[model samples]
Target: MKPLEGLLVLDFSQFLAGPSAALRLGDMGARVIKIERPGTGELNRQLSIKNQMVDGDSMLFHTINRGKESYAANLKDSEDAASVKALIAQADVLIENFRPGTMEKLGFGYDAVKELNSGIVYATVTGYGQEGPWRDKPGQDLLIQSLSGLAWLNGNADQPPVPFGLAVADMFAGAHLVQGILACLVRRGRTGQGGRVEVSLLESALDLQFEVLTTHLNDGGELPQRSAVNNAHAYLGAPYGIYETKNGYLALAMGSVIRLGELLACEALAAYQDPKSWFTQRDEIKQILVDHLQTRTTDEWLQILEPADYWCADVLTWKRLFAHDGFKALGMVQDVGREDGARRLRTTRCPIRINGERLFDTNAAPKVGEHNASIEQEFKLRDAQPSVGQHQPDGGERI
Candidate 1:
């Protein structure tokens, strides 16, 4: 059996961070039910990436929210809020990514949910933490990256600060929330009590740069210096970046500069025999290597370097990576189809294995309110008592 086979998760999160964590839980065999708004559902259903849509919903939504059931309800309505609270009472976990006070206003905050079900693992994601002055700022990936010094880590020293093409902040926060949730789950297994987990995009973004950031903090506040040429890592030394070859690019990891010079037959690299000069004179050494590497194709350089056990590889684009035997051997891709089989989406499978078997789920994301009737019936939500008045001090609408 999968680790989370019997657990039930109520995912109130709309976009990348919280839903991605819910998806990971589902991959581990949790029964995830997404509580979305009526009519409009989650905003991510319309948040398309590269304008790509599938089956009337954004591909971004499907990629992160697949293999889940959706139940539509308006938390602002007394009856709907009561029904949702009832569902939360039976849930093993609850995840939400609304702004700090939104859930509290709806009466589903962690304190209220804990009272409903004392053993529920309550997880939340925000732009910043609840107390920060920037808490109200939009929790967008690019903005978080820019604010957390992540953009400064990319590109050459002279080039403009570069943010990652992907939503690193959202994904990292999701992963962190999962870690916290799983830890709480373990503790619950032993203590018969659950706790709260809180992660913010800004916090996750900062944590991602812990190694360099900590170094900067302790080492007399020395700022990281990216190579002026072939910048890969901000703190790493020469031959630690990608270089353009005759036909393509080659990436070189940390290795002996002298050995690399001998292998590539570049006489200039031999002069930097002192390891200290590798960092101090990195730009000049990198320039020489860059000029020399451009004379040979990537494969030609790989052929010379690979045999000597050098830390070098020919960079592969998506198309090339897909065609490679190494990528195919991993079996990382899977095809998921909607219940009606009207369409199918081919995407990467969960990068995890249990008992030597890779996890695969064929279910696609549910349309808005697709499972509302069945979920209401199964949870006996229709019999729930609605709150009599405004939001309560305990954060319960009135269940």
Candidate 2:
């Protein structure tokens, strides 16, 4: 059985971060139900990547929301609010990414929720923390990256504040939320008292930069210098970036510059014998690599580097990586849906493996309120309107 086999998660948040946390819980066998607006559903339902839509919703939505049910309700509507409150009372977890005070205004804040379901783990995601000047700003990935100084760390030195091509802030925030939620679940298992988990995009983005930020904080507040040439990491020195070869690209990790010089027969690198020069003259050293690495093909460089146990790899695009035996062996991709697997959308499976067993769910994401009737019947939601200020037992009682 999965670790979260019997848990119920109400995903009240839209977009990547909060939905992703709920997705992880669903992967671990929690019964996740997205609480979305009636008719329109989630904002992400129309937020498409490459304008791709699947089964009437964005493929992006399907990617994050697969294997979950949806319950459509307008919180402003009294009957809908009452039903949702009833659901919250029985949920093992409740996740929301509304702006500060929005939940309170809707009567689902931590204090209000605690009264109905004392053991429900409440998770909130925001642009920033609850109390801050940035609390009201949009909780977007790029905005968080830009605001948290993450964008400065990407690309070469000459590039202007380049944000990550991926939604790194959202992804990291979701991962952190999962960590906090799981930790709370562990604590709830012990004390029988559920807790609140608050993760913000800005905070998670800063946490992502902890290593470089720590160096900056203790090293006399020195700002990180991005490498002028082929900068892979803002803090790393030479040979820590991807280089172009005669054919493909090769990624070289941190290693002895002298040893690399001897192996590549590029005598210029031998002049920088002092390890300190690796950082002090990072651009000059990387320039030498840029000029020399392209002298041979990526495969030629890999042939030489691999035998020496050097930290190097031939960079491959998704097409090449997917076809390679190394990628095929991990079985990273899976088709999800009820119909013939060949016809369904292909996506990545849960990365987590328990007892060496991979977690694979084939169910597709639900349409708006697809499971509403069944959920109403099962939970008897129509008759579960608790009185205002009603309090459940302090201990968690999963129904």
Candidate 3:
């Protein structure tokens, strides 16, 4: 049996944060009912690139919403709301990402749901929080990065702040939601009562940068301004960045002060042997290393460094990483065939492994209302089906 075998989750969340959390629960064998809208379902369905659906599937939607049963319903309809309440009555958990107070206004908030199912664990994934100054304000991942001081620490010191390549805020919030839900589940097991758990994108962003935030708080130091715009480890000291080799690049992470002497072993890098010289004259040491690295190919450096246990690696692109032996050994990549007779479907698998076995199988993202009939039959909800409301002409206002 899976970890959360008998638990049922009513996922009334859209986009990334809450959906990702719900997917994690689903991975652990929770029965996830993804509550989407009547027409297009999740907003991610329209975020296609160049008129092409990413990955021959809904890329954004699939990443965080796999292994879920879709239930398309317009919550604004009173009858639909009643049907949702019925689902909630039998659910072990309810996860939502609506703007603060929106759920309460619709009469299906934590209080309302808990009244019916006292043991329900309600998780709220918001941008700011439920009752802050920005509670009702609409926020995206970009805004949360700025608010959490992450943007300040990114990019070059002289240039404008840079947005991260990934939706770090949303991803972090999802992780926090998973942690909160697990903790709440344990609490419920002990007390026989459910609890409310809140995870905010802003809070998650801040939490991910705990090292930077805590250092600033304790030392009254300002967040680090990046000297190198594209470098991954911007805050760290010298010898911890990408250096151009004869062909492509090699990344070095020998930045630990204690490891400085060990990393500067090359004859060309002998000048940095003096601890004071290395500490005070980082530019000089960096230039020497850069010059030496430029003489050798990345492969040559890898051959030398791989055996030495130095924090070094040849910089690899996506294609290289996909075919990497390390990931292959870990079973991080898997093949999936489609009914359309596609050549190949190489997809990344879930990371969690228990006793050397994968925790869950690859469950593809469902089509709109794919399992509606099955769910209705299983829960005897066919008789309780809601009359989903129609969208209005004036931008479809919520009820």
Candidate 4:
């Protein structure tokens, strides 16, 4: 049986963080009902028009919102708002990503929702949080990167702070949402009561850089300027970092001090190899190692490094990595929601497995409001109340 077989989740979140948590829960066998703003739905629907489903659905939206049923309702409208509140009352979990005070203004915040369902786990995702100095400030992936110091750590010292490309804050906040929801669920199991589970993009991003943050905070030292391509490994000298290959790049690292010299394939620096030397003269050692690595092609060094049991990897682009046999063997990627069964609609599987089998059901993303009738019937709202009469405003407009 799946982990959360009987649980129900009401997803009022859009974009990344909030939807991500619902998706994970659905994969683990919860009944996730995704509530969208009637007509336009979630912002993610228009994120990648070109990559939309072959059948005209939003693939970008499907990628994260898969495994959940959609309930389109305009909370602003009276009839639709009733349905939303009814769904909230019947759910075990409720998730939203509106800015702080948004839910409260709309009358669906923790207090409001709790009044309807006191045992419901309420999760919120925001740029900063519900209340703080930057609570209402607009927060996104890049903003968090700057506030959390991640942008400053990447790229070269001479260059401006660079983004890490991927939306680390959004994704990490999604993960944090999952963790918070689960924690609340477990706590509710004992107390027969649910509580609020809150996570922020800024806080999540900062939590991800704990190692660097703790060190810098304790030392009260100014963060070192951004390090260059080869210089990113400044913390480790010689035998640690990317080395050039004939056609591409290879990463070689000897995290354990004792393994550094052995991994380098250079017998000349064996004496300076006293790992302690790295702490004292890291700069000189790195220069010598960098000079030596430039002497051999990546393949040549890999051939020796592998035999010596060094931690080494070839840096492959997404296309190359996807085609690699290792990915298939490790079950790192798999087709999702593909009816053809010919492996055409490929998607990376969740990075989790159970008993060697991936814990995912290949379900298509819902067409907008696909579950309206079913959810209405299931929640017994059809006979109890009329639909909210007011029409929902178009999304993208401030409420």
Candidate 5:
């Protein structure tokens, strides 16, 4: 049996961070029920990556939200809020990523939910922690990366700040939330009590740079100095960046500059025999290697350096990586189909294995409110009564 086979998760979150955590739980065999608005559902359905759409929803939504059931309800409506509260009473876990006070206003905050289900694992994701000046700022990935000082670490020294090409802040926060939730689940298994987990995009981004950031903090308050040419890491020394060869690029990791010069037969690199000069004169050493490497093809360099056990590789684009035997051996891709079997989308599978077997699931994301009737019947939520003073201006009722 899967680790989380009997657990139930209520995902009241949209977009990347919280849903991605729920996706990982589902991969481990949890039953996830996504609670969305009645008409528009989660806003992520409309948040497209590269304007790619599939089956009337964004491909980004379909990929992260696959293998889950959707229940539609207007949270402002007293009757719908009552139904959700009843469902919460039976759920093993609850995840939400609304702005800090939104859930508390709806009466589904950790303190409120703990009263309804004491053993529930409640997790929250936000742009920042509850009491910071930057808490109210939008929790977008790019904005968080900029605010966290991560953008300054990339690119050459002369270039403007460069944010990661992917939504790193959101994904990292989701992974961190999952770590906390799993830890709490372990404690609940022993203590018979639930706990709260909170993660913010800004915190996650900062944690991602702990190594370099720690160095910066202790090194006399000096800012990181990015290499003026071919900078891969802000703090690493010479021969630690990608270089353009005759036909393509080659990446060189930390290695002996003298040995590299010997292998490539570039006499100029031989002069920097002193190890300390590798860092102090990194730019000069890199410029010499760059000019020399351009004369040979990437394959030629690899042919010479690889057999000698040098730390180097020929850079591969997505097309080249997919076509390689190494990528195919991992079996990382899978096909998922909708309930009606009328549509299918190929996407990446969960990167995990249990008992020597890779986890695989074929279910696709549910359409808005697709499972409302069935869930209401199963949980007997329709018969639940709204608490006093639960009514609000919006159709939704307070918890």
Candidate 6:
């Protein structure tokens, strides 16, 4: 059994950050019930990647919302609101990503929620924090990256600032939210008192740059200098970037340039024997590597580098990586589909492992309000009164 097998999580959030946190708890074996709207449901049901959809919902939504139940309600309506409040009383955790004041306006703020269920782990995700000038700004991943100076850290120095191809702001913020929620849950387990977990894309973005930001803070407030040639990290030195080879690309991490020179037979790299020059003349050193690496194929370089304990690897495309046995060995992918087996989505599985067992769930995402009838029947929500909720753990090997 999974660690969260006894828990009930009410997901009142949409899109990536908040929803992904709920998704994680579900993966850990929580019975996650998504509180969506009546008709259109959450906004992400239509938010598509490559305009891809399966079974009338976006593949993006399928990937994130898989293995969860959905319960649709119009929170503005009194009957629906009261029914939801009943569910809230039963929930071990509650999550939302509405703007700062929205939850309070809806009478579901932390203060109000804790009154009903003092043990509820209230988790919130925002673009910015509740009290800030930027709080009202749309909590978008790109905007967070741009505003947080995260975008300024990518690409070659001459090139424009590049936001990550993936939604790092959303994913990291979600991961951080999970960390906080799990911590609060552990505390509640011991103390029988819950806590609030607040994470913002802006804060998570800044935290992602903690290493480089520390340098900026301590090194006389100097901004990062992106390498003019093949910049990988703004704060890193020579041979720290992905270089093109005869066939493909090779990534070299922090290593002795002299050793690399001897291995790859690039004599030019030997000149910068001074360790400090690795940073000072980084552009020149990198440029030398840029030109010399292309003379040999990536595999050829790997052949020379690997035997001598040099830190290097061949950069592979998704196609090559997926075809590799290394990727196959991880068992990272799984298929989830509807009950009828009419549709199936091949997506990534939960990354966590416990007691040497990998977690796998074949449960697919439910349609909007798909489980409402059953949930109402089980919880007796149609005529819910002010009653204490039940939480029974199907005994588990804690993860």
- Best TM-score among the predictions, by candidate number: 6
253-364: candidate 1 lDDT, tens digit per residue? 9999999999999999989999988889999999999899999899999999999999988889999999999999999989997888768999988998999999999899
List ranges where model 1 is wrong by over 4 Å: 384-399
Clashing pairs in 2: none
Which segments of candidate 3 are over 4 A away from where they belong?
54-57, 223-225, 228-235, 255-268, 273-280, 335-346, 382-399
Model 3 C-alpha lDDT per residue in residues 1-399, reported as the tens digit of each score: 667777888898988899988988887778889988886888876665456464444666666676688987778987666667667767778899999888898888887777777777899998888786898677699888887777777655566777788899998899899999888788777666677999899888988988767767786665454544234444565676678999999888754433543544466555555556544555556666677777878988888777768788888898998698875677776654433444434466667875667864556676677777777677666466432222111101100
For this target, which candidate reaches the highest lDDT against the unseen true structure? 5
Indicate the TM-score of model 2. Answer: 0.96
lDDT of 6 at 47: 96
What lDDT does the true structure give each of the candidates?
A: 0.89, 0.88, 0.73, 0.74, 0.89, 0.89
Local accuracy of candidate 5 as per-residue lDDT tens digits, 1-399? 887887889999999999999999999888899999988899999999899988888999999999999999888898898999888887778999999999999988998888777778899999998987888888899999898998989899999999999999999999999999888888777766778999999999999999999999999999989999899898899999999999999999999999999999999998999999998899999999899999999999999999999999889999999999999999999999898875799999999999988999899888999999999998899886433222111101110
- The C-alpha local distance difference test score for the whole of candidate 6 amounts to 0.89
Worst 10 residues of 3 by lDDT: 390-399
| TM-score versus the correct structure, for each prediction | 0.96, 0.96, 0.86, 0.87, 0.95, 0.97
Cα deviation of 296 in candidate 4 (Å)?
3.3
lDDT tens digits, residue span 1-399, model 2: 888888889999999999999999999888899999999999999999999988778999999999999899999999999999888877888999999999999888999999887777899998899986777888888888888898888889898888888999999999999999988888877777888999999999999988988988999978889998999888788879999999989999999999999889999999999999999999999999999998999999888888999899988999999999999988888888733342378899999998898999888888898889999888888887754433342223432
Clashes per candidate, residues 3 or more apart or on different chains: 0, 0, 0, 6, 6, 0
Model 5: colliding residue pairs: 75-396, 76-395, 76-396, 76-397, 77-395, 77-396
TM-score, structure 5 vs. true: 0.95
lDDT by residue (276-340, candidate 4, tens digit) is 77545554665556666777777777787787677788888889887989865777555566343
- For candidate 2, give the lDDT of residue 193: 80
After the best TM-score superposition of candidate 2, give how far the Cα of residue 89 lies from its true spot, in angstroms.
Answer: 1.3
Model 6 regions more than 4 Å off? 388-399
Residue-level lDDT for 80 in candidate 3: 65
For model 6, how does the per-residue alpha-carbon lDDT over 293-393 read when each residue is reduced to its tens digit?
Answer: 99989999999999999998878899999999999999999989999776898999999997889989898888999999999998888886534423322
